[model samples]
Target: MSMTPIVLDARTLKALAHPLRVQVVGTLRRFGPSTATQLAERLGVSSAAVSYHVRQLAAAGLVVDVPERGNARERWWKAAHDVTVADTRTLDEDDPDALDAYLRSIATAITLRIQQVLGARSAMPPEWRSVTDLSDFRARLTPAQTEELTERLHAVAEEYVRQHPESEAGPDAEMVSFDLQVLPDLDVGDRS
Candidate 1:
C-alpha cells in the first residue's frame, strides 16, 4: 500500500506554491480518492475552487483522476504520490521567489497540523497525549554533520514505515504524521 513519493522539481514546486493547491494534494493522498465536492467540504473551500486547483495539480502531474471510482457527475482525484519532498538545500538565488513560496506553504501546513494536535490534546485520551511530542534540541554541529543527521533521521522513519505499512496496521492503529525538520540556526550570536 506504499505509494511512491514525488520529489519536487522546479515546475512541480511552482505549481504547488499555492497553499490550497498543496493542501488539495495532501488531502487526497492522506484521505484517499475524493471528488472536488468532498475535498472542498473537508478543506472549507468552494467546490468550484477545489476543482480549479485540482486541475492545476493534474496539469503538474501531482494528481490524477481515479476514473474507476468516479461517476458521470463528478470525477474522483487522488495524489499521484503519497509524499511530496523538496530539497531546500538545493535552492539557489536563481528562483528564490518560487522556492521561498513553496517553503512558506509547507511551513504553514506543518504549523497548522501541529496546532490542530495541540488544540485537541486536552480532549485526547491519556495514552495518546502521553505519546505526543513538542520539543526541540539544540546542538553545535557543522553543516555536514547536520546533513548527515537529517539523512539518518529520515532513513529511520522510512525504515519504520516499510516495516509497518498502513495495510498491515491493526484496528488500534492511528494515522500519524511524522514531521521532522533539521534546521540550523543562522544567527547564533553566542546564544541559540
Candidate 2:
C-alpha cells in the first residue's frame, strides 16, 4: 500500500505535540520499520511506554503495523508517510498558537537529533562533510524566476531520490536529515 502522507490537522498536531512522539515518528520514517522493543531500547524507554505511544500513533493514523516475516512474535511498525507536516495555515487562521508550538517542537526535536548525530559521528565521510560552510544569499527575482528556481531545486531532489533509492534501513545505512524553513530573519535588517 502507498504510504499515507501525514497532514497535521489541529488534533493530529496536538497528538504529536510531545517531543518523544516526534522523535518516534522521525525514527520510523528514517528506519522504515521497528518494533516497540527496538524503539524502547533505542530511546532508553520502557517497552510498555513505547508500545503505548505506538498505539497512539497508530490510532492517529500516523503509523501502521506491518506484518513481520519469519517472526510471528515481533510487532513491526512503519510510518504511514514518507513525509509528515505541520502547516496549520491549512487548517485555520486563528490557530497560529498551535502552529507555532508545533513548529517549535519539530525544530527543537530536529536540532537535538542533529547534534546527537554529528557528535556521534566525529568524522563524517569526506563526501558528506566536504563543505562545512553554508552559502546563504538573497536575490531579487521576478515571480517566474523564483518559481523556476524552486522547481529546479525540487527536480534535483527528485532525481537524487530516483538515482539513489533508499535501501532497507539498517546499521549499514544512516539516515541523513535535511530541513529548510523560510521565515522572517529577525536578526537581519530589512533588505527590501
lDDT of each: 0.86, 0.72
Clash statistics: count for each candidate: 0, 0
By summed lDDT, the worst window of 10 consecutive residues in model 1 runs over 87-96
lDDT (tens digit, per residue) of candidate 2 on 64-159 = 888753177788998888777555458557466667776777888877877776685557876667544334656666667766776687677666
Model 1, position 106: C-alpha lDDT score: 81
- 89 in model 1: Cα distance from truth in Å? 4.2
Summarize candidate 1's per-residue lDDT along 112-185 as a digit string, tens digits. 77887899999998988899988888889988999999999999988988888888999888888888878877
Compute the lDDT of residue 11 as modeled in candidate 2: 75
TM-score of 2: 0.72
